[model samples]
Target: MKNYKLRRLSDQPILKTSDVKPSVDGFEVLGAFNPAACLVGDEVILLLRVAEAPRGKEGFILVPLIEEQNGTPELAIKEFNEPAAPYDPRVVTLNGKVYLTSLSHLRIARSRDGIQFTIDENPFLFPARMDESFGIEDARITFLEGKYWITYTAVSEHGPGVGLAITTDFKTVERIGMILPPPNKDVALFPQRINDKYMLLHRPMVSDIGKPSIWLAESEDGVHWGNHRFLFGGRGLADNPFAWEGAKIGAGPEPILTDEGWLLCYHGADPTHSYSLALALLDKNDPAKVLDRSDAPMLTPELLWEREGFFPNVVFSNGWIQWPDGRIWVYYGAADSGVGVAELVRE
Candidate 1:
């Protein structure tokens, strides 16, 4: 899409590494991960991405903490210092010493308002051995039928896919295994069932058939999904040769049902690997029909920190919370390093 636009809530990082725990033993907090926000006890609670460690490490795992030293948040690495487990080059390394790359984990942070936040002492979610060996990213929380449903990316060496977790209280989560398998991601379930059936937006990658596009599916139960159909495809633009989502486009957060239609915040990536956020309006009943979509990005990497980080020129969001005050608060990961927030007009 080309004509859509977005406004920056905070030009600089409002909730940066300072909002998380600090690093110990020469390690430091790097970035935050997939953020899930909700209203708890009249407060906006944020599930932030807290990636920690020193620059250039291969084998160490960094856990974030709030440190008194320099009064700055940093990461503390769990050093193996073992010769057998060699360092992985994929993670950052500093000096001549090698540290293992830290995997992404979900940590809780609370704010009386929504702007300033303080991280919880403990993490709300971590990688489970059954399938999420790599890490979990991008979680969409839907409070449905008195229960909260979380759909997130379950990563492993096998590949990245979508997984389901249910919870009545945010403290405990019950795993529902991988809901969707490899070569697919960006799954968002409708908050309520339509015609007694569950609806979801998913992206199934087909390298040979065509470019990655959005698909719609329905299920009797939330677990098993079927009736998959291609919902939308990329459209090319003159200025943006790699337009129509040069790479892919999928549902971002849960669809916000409004009088206009179903407002969907989605992410689109170009061939150059730059990722940005966009919006689409779908028919309330027949989500397969698109009413309107943003031609340009709603959010992009323009800030200095957003342009210069782990993965430059990237702004990805897993979830957003709409307040009763007609404000939609968007929480996204900036450059894959840390999390940031943006507010948009609900209408």
Candidate 2:
């Protein structure tokens, strides 16, 4: 096995919330991060999860939500009275019901150098269905079968679920509805079929008996999934060397096919809820068999931008672009607020 290292580029956040304009009239762009990246011709494209919210008012807390009215999804703000104590700025318990502080939608960003990006004025994907009424977020893009397949989280009152969409041109996208049911998310589809079946990586939440972990599922038509199996999880508890992922782990960008195996980038959260990025390798023939994984996080929240903001101490990614020469450009969300990139190279 060869050693690898992640080098953070000089330009820390390639994109910021201020760079994006809100879709709603009175809403403001809070965060523009966690992009799904890809290459189209000579241009590098990003599908960014842009979170927006209305300004706070005195003695009241406002929650942005997507509501369906006359078969059209509109951005709506629900206000709650005073001292509505929040678990975090991202979430709040209002009248015994949980609500997100912001409503997220997918927006387009294009770049020629992969560092400087121009954000599109309008949204690419928004909360249209009831399942995505809360918001859609954290997309993973995989180019397969002559189209770009996007797997993202569809959040609603029920829970977060996996939703799929496809597009040939970024201008138009067709939703494939929800593939995985509630309490599941972080989905990434393999670029190609293995052993005559489509393979997908996802994370399922568990509360009572087990913790959230990465799992594998198989699909025959790329819509219906089955043959679910546990793929990876935290090594052990606090004393364990891999405890950085003790709280939970989820798949990041789509797996890259390498000579050694399938190179996968993933995020792991510790007990403190601090998130970091790690790498893993799966068997080329049998993806269910884990070949190797990182002992420690390759990318951690060290910089001030990564350590502070909305939902601090987090570095999460669902996107990366690989060159023919094996250089990988990893685009990550720093502090759930801005987008940053790092270079993954073999040492």
Candidate 3:
């Protein structure tokens, strides 16, 4: 495998939780990270997953939920003195019901230099349906035909599922509903169709039989997906519980097409759940055929911001932009709290 390096553009996080304001009135911004980036004309646009939670008080623990009133979404808080389950910062369980500690929604941020950005005050996309009662998160944007197809995770009481939305300009968006059902996320669609069929990479949660891994599927239309094939990770083929990707692996930024093949940047976590970025190349025609993969991660949590935050020791990317000059800009979430950018240099 060829050695590739990801050089950090800045020592500090480019966009932090404090950089973003909460969508709701009483809520506070807990995180502004995991952005899906693309170039609309000359400006780089980011669809960021903004996490919010109600203001903290002394005694009660607050769990935020999205409730609709007159067809408009509003914040609803559930206060609990004690959780039915053990204390977990990510989730709160009470009275046999589970709720997320923070609610997430997609917001827009625009940048002229791809480093510094000005975020939109209001949410670009929020919970509007029962399946997305929790929130929408981790969007991967793929421009197809004449419109951009956004594949994201819709969180609810059921589980995390893949949802789709379409937009030409960021001003207006059309929700296409859930594309892939619950227990699935980390979905990225290939920019162009392969073999006259649309393709995507997804990670489905597996516990009873196998471990979670990256899988490939095909569809005539981008909405309905099938032809499921295991590409990497899971029970066999190594990398599962290996050094860096010992715990699990998921699709990161949308696959980039190159002369050699399709370059895929993905994230893998060790047993400690420390996330890092890795690389893989797939056949130009047959994406399921892996050409070369990184023996180790090209980028890992080394910076202070990356090692500590809401959920520490993590660096994940769901969006990136490869400029016309062949310069690749990788925008990633650090410690699940802040957004950072790096340049991927191929030697």
For each candidate in turn, give its C-alpha RMSD to the true structure in angstroms: 7.1, 1.4, 2.2
lDDT score at residue 251, model 1, on the 0-100 scale = 78
Give the per-residue lDDT of model 3 (tens digit) for 1-347.
46688899999999999999887888899888999999999999999999998898766788887778788766678888864556987787777888898989999999988988999999999888878989899999998888999999999989999999999999999999999999999999999999999999999999787778999999998899999999998222334435688678999978999998999999988877888898889999999999988887888999999999999999998988989899999999999899989999988
Better of 1 and 3 by TM-score: 3
TM-score of each: 0.81, 0.97, 0.95
lDDT of each: 0.71, 0.91, 0.90
Cα lDDT tens digits, model 1, 262-328, are 8888888877778888888889888889998886677878887777777788888877888877678
Q: Which stretches of candidate 1 lie over 4 Å from their true place?
A: 1-5, 22-28, 52-101, 237-244
Give candidate 3's error at residue 41 in angstroms.
0.6
Q: What are the per-model numbers of colliding residue pairs?
A: 34, 0, 1
Q: Which residue pairs come into collision in candidate 2?
A: none
On lDDT, who's better, 2 or 3? Answer: 2
Cα lDDT for residue 234, candidate 1: 68
